[model samples]
Target: MRTPLPKDKCVAAAPLCQSDGEIAIIAEFLPRRIELTRADPGCISFEVKPTGDPRVWDVCECFQDAGSFELHQGRVASSEWGRATAGITRSYSVAGL
Candidate 1:
C-alpha cells in the first residue's frame, strides 16, 4: 500500500450573511463547529467572527489540502445545524496568510 503524501492547502476566508433570527442559532453553532473542526485530523484552524455589518460574519479555515477541505465541507453540508440558517451569503478567497 502506498502512503498518501501530505498536500499544501490554501487558507480560505469568507464573509457570510444571515437573517436576524438565524443569527442566534448561527452564533451557538459557529463556536461548536470551530472547536470540532479545529480538532479534526487535517484541520489547521477554524475561526468565526462577526463582521462590522450586523448581518454579516466572517469565517476563516485552514486544512491540509483540497481533500481535507472537501471533507470538512461535506461534514458541514450534512449538518442539520447548517440547514436551519436561511438567507446565507458567502464570499470566499484564497487567504494569503
Candidate 2:
C-alpha cells in the first residue's frame, strides 16, 4: 500500500496546453525542464506527458511543499521555457498547499 501524503506538505498541479505551437514549445523545452525539476531536492515527483490529443499534454507535478513549488515557479518564470510558453493557455489546480 502507498503511504498517504502529509496534508499541506505537498503541492500538486495539472496544467494543460492546447495548440500546435504550444505543443512544439513543450517538445523543445520540456525534456530539459523535466530533467532540472526532477533533480531539485524539493521535488516529490514531476511528470509531463502527451495526451491522446496530439496537441495536448498532461502536466502533473508535486513538490515537497508550497515553498518548494513557489521556488520552482520563480525558477521557471526566468527560464527559457517560461519565455517560450508564456502565452499558452493553461488550467491549473493545486492540492496540499
Candidate 3:
C-alpha cells in the first residue's frame, strides 16, 4: 500500500450562485465537508469563506502532496455538496507554505 504523504497548503475560489437557498445549502454542507477532510492524514486545513458578493465562495485547503491533493480532490468532487454546487465555477491553486 502507498503511504499517505504530508499535507500541502492550498486555496480554492469559486463563483457561487446568487440564490439565497443556494448560499444556505453551501453554508450547511461546507462545515461537514471541512470536518471530513480534516480527519484525513493528508489534510492540513480546510476552510470556506463567503465573499462580500453573494455570488462568490472561497475555499482554502492544505494537502500533503500531489497524490494527497488528487485524492482530496476526488473526494470533494464526488461529495453531495460538490454535486449540489456543480453550477459554480471553481479555481484552485497550491501554496508553498
C-alpha RMSD by candidate, in order: 4.3, 4.3, 3.7
- What is each predicted model's overall lDDT from 0 to 1? 0.63, 0.72, 0.70
Clashing pairs in 1: none
TM-score (C-alpha, index-matched) for candidate 3 = 0.72
Q: Candidate 1, after superposition: displacement of residue 11 in Å?
A: 4.7
Q: Per model, state how many residue pairs clash.
A: 0, 0, 5
Could you give candidate 3's per-residue lDDT for residues 1-97 as a string of tens digits? 4443334446556755668877777777777877888886677677777788866877677666667777877887898867877776566565653
Q: Would you give me the overall lDDT of model 3?
A: 0.70
Ten consecutive residues with minimal summed lDDT in candidate 1? Answer: 1-10
How do the residues 1-97 of candidate 2 rate in per-residue lDDT, one tens digit apiece? 3343464434433345666777788788889989988887578788777678766666677777667778889998888978988887776767767
Residue-by-residue lDDT tens digits, candidate 1, 1-97: 2223333334555535455666667776766777778876667667677778766766667776657667877877777555755346667776323
Give the clashing pairs for model 3. Answer: 6-64, 7-63, 7-64, 8-63, 8-64
- TM-scores, all candidates, are 0.70, 0.79, 0.72
Rank by lDDT, highest first: 2, 3, 1
User: Model 3, stretches more than 4 Å misplaced?
Assistant: 1-9, 95-97
Best by lDDT: 2
